[model samples]
Target chain A: MTLVKVYVTYKESILDPQGEAIETAIHGMGHNDINGVRMGKYFEINFTDDAKDIDTEIDTICDKLLANPNMETYRYEIVNAEGAK
Target chain B: MTLVKVYVTYKESILDPQGEAIETAIHGMGHNDINGVRMGKYFEINFTDDAKDIDTEIDTICDKLLANPNMETYRYEIVNAEGAK
Candidate 1:
């Protein structure tokens, strides 16, 4: 089986309010050395050994479903299923 | 500066309805080779060089805010901030 690890995050130009809120909360908790924080989505996808055109499939999936083209960007890594947790 | 990448996910015994729904959608889109999918949270945090006991602080933050200890688990990696995007 193949395992794909995908991360989707807001574009650099976008303002991440949620991340800002978390950063404030963290600061309130006394971690003042933190400079910034960004939050994103993570996904683990497992494919059967018979799956074909896996690379193309992953890109299609990310563009069409996993990320918003206007505000977010995504990247992924493919690895043997056995190597992932 | 320091960069910390954090990944938080549901515990093995937890039911991930969102992931299952996405998997169904993917299959409906003709990606029948997919076996399963799991969804999680990702974070990128930047800290100044003066941050003290970062490992301990990260543990505290994850336990108190980033994850629900009963249902989720988290892991992180630290690297030079300049190396991250």
Candidate 2:
């Protein structure tokens, strides 16, 4: 089996209110050095033995569902469990 | 400034309905090789110059808000924008 980790984040043009809220809370907690914060979604996917061309499969998965191309950007890394060196 | 990327995911014991829905959709799209999927929260934090002991700060931040101790697990990596190579 292989595990693919995908990170999806708001596009640079999108405003992130949740992140702003977090930043405010951090400041109130005395973390005065913090400049800003942004938030997004993450996913961990496991591929069984039947999967082939994992990269292409993930690209399709991201484009089709994992991320909204209009408002978000995504990147992924695959961890081959069998090759856990 | 430096950027810290944080990923907070549901603990193995937690059931992820959102991920299950995605997996079902993927299967509908014909990618039956996918076994399981899990969802999580992602954050990008920027640290201004006054910040020190980033690891400790992040540990506090994650423990304080980024994650739910009872249900989520978090990990982070620091990216030094100034040292980009």
Candidate 3:
């Protein structure tokens, strides 16, 4: 089996209000040294060994359902599922 | 500066409805090769050079805010911000 780890995050030009809010909350808890924070989404997808065109499928899945191209960017790593476990 | 990447995910025993929903949607889109999916949260935090007790602070933040101890677990990697970029 193949395991894919995907990370989706906002583009540099986009404003991440949720991240800012979390940063503010963290500062309130007295961790003043933490200067910045950005929030993102993570996904782990498992594909059977027989799956065809894995790379193409992953990209299509990310573009169609995992990320909003207008605001977010995504990247992924494919690894053997057995080794991952 | 220090850069920390935090990943938070549901514990093994927890049911990930959102992940299931996404998987269903993907299959509906004709990606039958995908067998499993897990959704999680990711955070990138930057700490200044002057930050004290970095490791301890990270643990406290994760325990208190970044993850729910009852249902979620988290892990992080810390790296030099300059080198990471």
Q: Which candidate is the best by DockQ?
A: 1
lDDT of 3 by residue, A2-85 (tens): 899999999999999999999999999999998889999999999987898889999999999999999999999898778443
RMSD of each: 1.2, 2.3, 1.2
Tens-digit per-residue lDDT, A17-45, candidate 2: 99999999999889988888999999888
Q: Give per-residue CA lDDT, model 2, range B1-85, as digits (tens).
A: 8889999988888988998998899999999888888889999999986777999999999999889999999999999867321
Give Cα distance to truth, residue A51, candidate 1, Å.
1.4
Q: Write the per-residue lDDT of candidate 1 for residues A1-85, one digit (tens) a residue.
A: 8899999999999999989999999999989999899999999999898988989999999999999999999999999868654
In model 3, which runs have C-alpha deviations exceeding 4 angstroms? none
- Write one digit per residue (lDDT tens) for candidate 1, span B34-73: 9889999999988888988889999999999999999999
| Quality of candidate 1 docking, DockQ | 0.93
Pairs of colliding residues, candidate 3 = none
Cα shift from native, residue A58, model 3 (Å): 1.0
Error of 1 at A38 (Å): 0.3
- DockQ value for model 3: 0.92
Q: In every candidate, how many clashes are there?
A: 0, 0, 0
